[model samples]
Target chain A: MDSSPLVLTLASIILASTPLIIAVCGEILTERSGIVNLSLDGTMLMSAMTGFVVAFETDNVWLGFLGAMGVGAFFAFIVAFGSIRLRQSQFAIGFVLTLLGDDLSAFLGQNYTRIPGPVVQHYAIPILKDIPIIGPIFFNQNVIVYFAYILVFVTWFWLFRTQPGLRLRSAGDRPEAGFARGVGINFQRYLYTIIGGGLVGVAGASYSLNIKIGWAEGLTRGFGWIALAIVIFGGWSPIRGMFGALLFGATKALATYLQRTFPEVSVVAFNAIPWVLMILVLLLVGSDFTERVITVAPKSLRRPLQRFLKISPPQALGSTFVED
Target chain B: MNANRWIRWVWPAVPIAGALVVTSLLLFFFGAAPLEAFQAMYDGAFGDQAKTLSVLAFWVPLLLAGTGLLVTFKAGLWNIGIEGQIVMGAIAASWVALRMEAPSAVLITVEILAAMLAGALWAALSAVLKTRGNVHEIFSGLALNSIAIIFTNYLISGPWQPPEGGTFRGTAPFQPGALLPLYENSRFSPLSLLLAAIAFTLVVIALRGTFWGLKLKAIGQNLRSAFLLGVSSEREMILAMMLCGALAGLGGAVRTLSWFDSLRQSISGGIGFMALLVVMLANYRMFLVPPIALFFSAVLSGSITLQLRTQLHSSLGGILTELMVLFVLLFGDWKKLGVFRKKDDDG
Candidate 1:
């Protein structure tokens, strides 16, 4: 059963989604702090380039990850400083940085393109890897993938089950209230944004060193945008975001499966699936149609449905918090 | 008054200089000579008549996209789906060109109209999604943009494959009647430039001299208050988006008919996104659109040669432009500068 195509595909899907899972986690934290770092696409591209280059030059994968985290934090710091202190438009600056990061990565990675670099070593948990189908699908992966799994639960716990989490939520939802409670709103925004950006940086490094394994122009190009969409689909919760990432991975795997099964089908057609899914998933959460559906449902189903389908962005997601 | 005039000239220069320093430092870090790269880029963009004309040809579509964005920006809409509008326009024009056979003048006129209508409809989708479904235009626009590209790929590869076969390049070059007349064996079309200029002038007038422009300004400043003042925010927002889409569609038509003479993949080639950058760099000002768009066009065109001469990546132009916009956003407000604050305090 473990060697069957179904199990193999499921295993690969888990492996492929690690970066996206990591990226969504990062973005959730950032957006929760009332900052939208729309530069995820470019940041990932630049950091992917940086990660590969540093690893190649230093012959150390850990250093590459560190360098990437630093780069990510630096970019997020700029976003935080500009939006929080300088009071510029977050979207505009983020968009510009996306374009800049793309170009900068291409220009800087010119020499690094297609060169062999350090690859993340795989380490399956000894006992866990032996635990039937689930073991092979989840536990039998590289350290980065394992780290992503742990990060998801940690993120969920940090955001929902802690005292600091309440302050963070207040920082995004009601800055005035948070300020009244003596929270350093700006400082919280900066700290969380940088930390989230560093996680995104890890996602980028994961791509270059583990999943994709080389430097190239536009390496991991559209994934960042997809990750952004997934953050919305997940309704700003890390646990839900992980499922969104997995669903995206499953669709991609299905596309690959279809292409292999039906060679006559143009592969380009399948490229549209994730994007179309992005629209549909967003529609599901963004519209009040879900609420209407819940209204018509049985009482027992309605509560569970409401818990699952409810989606609302942070009140101060894109606005500058001017504290008195 | 003289100092104020001088300050206006000098202030904008700050961001440009900052961009230059940052780009130069990037080059220096990468072991490339900044001066040499800049020289190469300049030579590549304006080395001769052909290069200059190429820049102008590129400028026409970019200028149109930038001009259209002024309307949406005035109404406080992002309209990022402008890229899709351009793509839909190209597809519409392509459909007419591929299916309809008529005199050149009639065919061209119909194609342009079809392109504009298609673009308007596409933009309208995002607007409706926002007003009715409560989805943000940014997300809807992005989704629609992907759908447009997917539709293009499906059409070119599946239904509209060339007579010989499909290599995914594009439909066979359109009949002469379907294509815009070129000038001096170049892809440049004088008619498209004229159309773009007309669009620019009309938008400027619409934005500066009309009550509609005032309403849009009111909406942009505060939508709730604008609604309270009896303005129909929904209708105006939709109209602004459609207007921008129409202009962008014309840009796509220009691109397909003049730039490549076929409905090719990636036909918009980031022109719509570049237009977003151009408008942002212009600080959403109307009159500044043309010159800034032209500058961006020149830089991009020059980067092609800069790649060959300096062995640098062609995205060097994108980096330079993006940095300028970034710095401007960070420090563009002259009143926020410490020196100006002191001056205001003295006054």
Candidate 2:
């Protein structure tokens, strides 16, 4: 086998996995806080559509990025409202939001299909760009790629190495403990979920701004699901999640490579490889991963932190600390 | 006591009223007069015997799919892969329909059975993963949906491709003898409707009058408690999935034998998701599924007419259906409102 093609293939996989890396990392943070948001798929889809539309209209890729973040935040707010304020079932509300997001995207995006948008250009570092095999692959990428790496590090640092991160984790893991310490656990959850959602939105926008540069019906095509799966595979840690995403990206890239090489193998089966791989990874990892990581999940996230239900938020997460 | 009795009726009614209001508002936004659009929808769906039959044609598959979903819901499982199961079912039915040379009656029966079995088996994968492998049913169900679509695509594009190259996107048409005969020059097939009705009735009876239904409901409300009570929650979950898959598979078979004659790419056509909406709106009540399913089918059938008569895209039917579900879910909480609030120990 030619190393050149393999090298090129590896490079492509890295690029493909960047969005998943970012999105899953964000979701890990949100879930660590104790809420399960199944609406990420819809959030990504809507953001992808919005990013493309805004980019095309404004000719500024940054605007598309921001627009996608706004839309993503808005969707997260809806999930928050339903799960936290309304006391609805987290899974049900998340599912409904997913459906609603999908339809809303389709309704709004009907006209923008196939339209060209502003494509983010690569900014190669002179020294790094010249480094043989790794140079072009790693050093010669657009801002979004760099931003994805930055986000991974930022998230990793924020999660493990900072005070606020610890508090956020506490809020998610044991809201009662956090609340007993006088922390407003619900507010922390609300803050982090909205911010995490905004990041996921950016990840979604990156699909259009950096990857495909256009929109299509069902364009996300279960990428959100892949991201969700990756969050678990990564053990809900930013660094691990990034690795899982890269692994998936590699598999996806390999599938594409194999499809081109082995034209005889049905493309339909090839397309299914990622989903099959996700299921396999999920099964192999077992349910312990979900239990372990989720055990530390924020109390507010436990039961639709956004909805108004019979249960109160981790007894601490959502309280505003009203003084007598 | 009388007021308390009325509360039961009010729970279901409020959601319906809210849905209607929301639908009207959506129609108004679309620049169609709400009343006129409603009239058009009514006429399009049931203006004539032919139209009524067309509505029934759509209704049967949806009703069947919804009924299958209800079974899973009873067992505290959400089988979102109904779409995939339906697709697989169609594939199985089409495979048999296209190949077999048996008598129509025998072939149709075999095809239906084959489809149901295939669907049940596909659904069983999720159950096995959930019960034995500890994979969440939701994740398994979602993953199965993707796998199903891919499998369908492979079959259609490869083994099942019609001989014609340019236009045919599905399997070859079934033999005339293999097809289910419709009643007297009507587009509606009584066979499908009758099958759907019987299936619904059976499910209703099973849920209300059988020990199994009680076991299923018990598990759905609290799996741990059910397990403690020796209900075999895991087994019941698997059984529910199989039953759900079988009903959906039967619906797929009926569509192939009675309506299409050939298996198309979009044979299931989002019916699984639509059925989900129907089930949710009906609050997972078995008897409530039919009327809701019929109402949705009428909306869909009417949309085709609206497309022919107006400039609106047929996709409007899908939009309306999604909106209807959203409205139902949104206002489903009206019973908690102050006006309807029950007197309690605390405010």
Candidate 3:
């Protein structure tokens, strides 16, 4: 029931990060399946444009989401087919798709730029939103934000708790063994990649339809790469990735606050914080130096340090899959 | 063997045709005439002396960047940090032009050298991260790219603001001596183009005739095998990246000194990225780089007029090029086409 700047900023941070949370979750799933969908930046742009345009024309928001998801799934299918069936480099295919998606969005969305469109109505959960700081920040948001909250936990449960999740992990971590066990490796890759891409599409729709509220050239440029970085920073765990998104959101909020507070300062440089943080976080997690430092630490500190710092990727993240 | 000779020439056309078809369908979907758009683009690129000169000016930097990428690609490294290298090159040249006072020729030479050094050092950071820290070049390169852009923002807004005020547009124009000698009113500078041409020749020589080139190929093919054969893979990779960065930096120097009078925000303006696409479309063939880069430059340069004549987004240029590269990569394999062969040979 409060309108304090602190509460509002916190709420806004959560709202802004919803798209990233969904995207990181999707990319985490894809990479967990040993497929790196590097087309996230372009996929997000294309879907945002498609979501906005479809929603604008049909006057139905859900259809927009569906259309966006279809676009996402199609792009992912290409990646899966190229890497899995044709044995082409996933990075090469993904990079091209990213460019194609960007250019396509700009060209197609030309007629639709800056146009007002249907928006997702705000809804607050009566009971949960009544709580203190946490409720205002988490529960007092739109349906997509609510979905993002559930999605992270659901992703964690799906990856760790379910049998199918175990098979998915095996597909990415050890495809040969999985195939030997008759896991239908390529099929799982295609299925998960598409599903993950659909979620990414939902993230894009959330941006145009909910958070940012308009389509433009490069509607969500650079954030997709940030999500990719956060996935690594999260160690490919949905929960950790959620935290990474939140941290990025907080930095952005802080940058905006600083710019407003100190009118003379050029905080445009602050836009680079997420990227700089990306490198620093990856270095902390991915570098051998950190491992050595953890080794030299006190024995009691070593366990927690290793637990905190362990961020290895799936063993077969970018390689082609072959059926013998 | 005889079939292969003709196949190589024919193979290149398939992707080109596929690209045209896809772009045409896209234009038709949007209710635009595809042929009209293409004609507009062609005219824009070569409509007159100035337009063609502009295309050539754009081609110089693109050619330089693509030439550098050839070295990195040969070493099996994706030097995506090249965008940052180019930016860093511009900043270094700007720093020299802004602060140093010297003879015209000496200042130009020093500015270029500084730009090359700065670019190489920036690229070396990515190389070091890959080799020493085990961070992938893609991620590091992306991060470095952002950092370089941010650094430019800081310089422009804070320290390097023009004498009049802080517009965030760019620093003040350099002294006449600091700039490359332009050809009439055009952005094209014969010196810069000559430099690009020389860089291309040197790279071709290095890749074709030198032992270092063979070592790079070995490292690219199989890192473990190369190491087993007494080649230092890490050092070679670093050297390759630095060499690529140096050439890319030269491109940046050309961009700032000749293309524009001063260092502007987004100085390279996706030229570095376009070069990456150019090299990819060229299939990493050194010989294909120049013509392909020139084509890309013309397409992009012509897209300016495309936007005016068609009321379409200028990204049509990007769309066409990306589609071409994608189709080429997807269908380039002769066995996949099955045009000249009957059975699919499983690799």
Candidate 4:
């Protein structure tokens, strides 16, 4: 009946990583179809606050998540419409939305500050929870966490092994070619971006309802940019992004643990670890740098190492498609 | 032709008017009367001589940062990391204010230079990453910003914490000599104003008349051809970034040496970003930077009063800034944004 540190930390990591996992997976799917939704941070904040407010008022957590998704999708639709139909810069619009969304959330969320609301209840799968440490870490969590676990596999399977997934990848990679092959490139982009936004909304709802547990200004302050970075670090792959999300979650958990144990060390220093590491990784893992490194590497180690650090942005991302 | 020329000067105002209308709707929705909010906003911005000077004081950093942003925009770079550069500049100035001793004039000079150098160096790191490491400026800038904030937080709340135990208030107040000269009990410092105005004037001159400015234009137009023409692309890129960084640093220094006695985590106060919007609104014209900066500073000053007098949030300033940017993006000529060339339309 006693809480063990190891078990608790592991459980916390899973819970901590869930929101990020959902966010990264969402971003991966969106970027795979060649759209950059730079509004993850704002979307998450707005949705988290909305989710919390709605859940607090409705006495239902699922409604809050749904409301958050709707908010997320609405923002994504705006970005998609701007980029696809209006022929404006997606990057510019998304950047603007990040500021706009943050302000809107702060303005609207004035009444909801520090208000306690319903949180997602923990539910353990009976047979699975009885297993070793892995079971406890994986199965003994909320439904949102379980959904995040399922999302990684489902996203990977859909992106790599299905027909629509091929269309999606082609829409991002080479839109002209996909268009010639009868794919509605812009429509596909719109659909995927909104879908991605919806998942990002779920991530936001998960944060307020399950992980961090409240509405606050700057609740997900730095997390959105981290998710955006992870998408790049993961090289636009669902599985890699999922792993990157988990790695980031573990790093955060480790930082929190370190902050507690090493009281003398400034907490900000611990907080800076992930950002510094992300930048260093981003610089070192550029496609060109990786190419040169792999070319000069010893034969046996090169392939696996190359595979490990591989990251390539979607070729047609952030540019509007035009017929030649 | 004269009418057309006249309209060109008036076009930027349309967005401001449109944004005001949009903001009115938002205010009304939030239960504040549009007229009352506008009257309150105007009164807060320029109701008295004291208010006018305060607006001028706040405009200095935005002006400096906007001019810096104009430099980067000229080179077709987005120096979003200016926020970090601003913070780094403050840290450097504080380092001098606390650790070094000199005459008042000499001390302020060294502090300003150190701040600019620190900001330039921080920005230069992002430039190097982009030029040598193949990382985009946006990502590098975004990441660096978080890192710089953490670094500033560490200094302010940890090692550089005031001796009176720790709080998020900021470091111990700087010595009297470190603070900028204030004007007859007004918060405004005429010296800081002169410094900012002089820096912006030099930048405007350089942009209009210098060979380096022409080369930046050429490079921004077409990187490969400009490089083929012997315009050192990497060198120009780094120099442009550093100049902007230094400019943003100057903004930071003014804030440090003039307004506030101690450095805090919110020292930059998003002035770098606000300046970014100003730069875009100014259409890269250095002459327009001050007015735009003043308008923004007014919005900010007014928003503070709005918060005090009503249940409204201070984030209304951010909303208004976003509104202005959005309106401009939607209706203003895209060519004015500097990303599109008018010549291309002709061709």
DockQ, each predicted model: 0.53, 0.34, 0.60, 0.46
Top DockQ prediction, candidate number: 3
Q: Between which residue pairs do clashes occur in model 4?
A: none
Q: What is the TM-score of each candidate against the true structure?
A: 0.95, 0.87, 0.95, 0.92
lDDT of 1 at A135: 81
Highest lDDT model number = 3
Off by over 4 Å in 4: A1-3, A260-264, A287-289, A298-303, B1-18, B218-225, B283-286, B333-347
Chain B TM, every candidate: 0.95, 0.90, 0.96, 0.92
lDDT by residue (tens digit), candidate 4, A55-134: 99998999999999999998888788767766666666677778777888888888889888899999989888877777
lDDT of candidate 2 at residue B31, scale 0 to 100: 70
Q: What root-mean-square deviation over C-alphas does model 3 reach? A: 2.2
Off by over 4 Å in 3: A260-266, A298-304, B1-9, B337-347
Give the least accurate 10-residue stretch of model 2 chain A, judged by summed lDDT.
A305-314
- Please state the error at residue A167 of candidate 1 in Å: 2.1
lDDT of 4 by residue, B217-298 (tens): 8877788899999999889888988998998888888887776888887889788878877877665777888988998899
The lDDT per prediction is 0.88, 0.77, 0.89, 0.84
Estimate, for each residue in B108-213, the C-alpha lDDT of model 1 and write its tens digit: 9999999999999999989887776677787788878988998899889878888999978988889989999888988899999999999999888888899898
lDDT of 4 at B49: 88
lDDT computed for candidate 4: 0.84
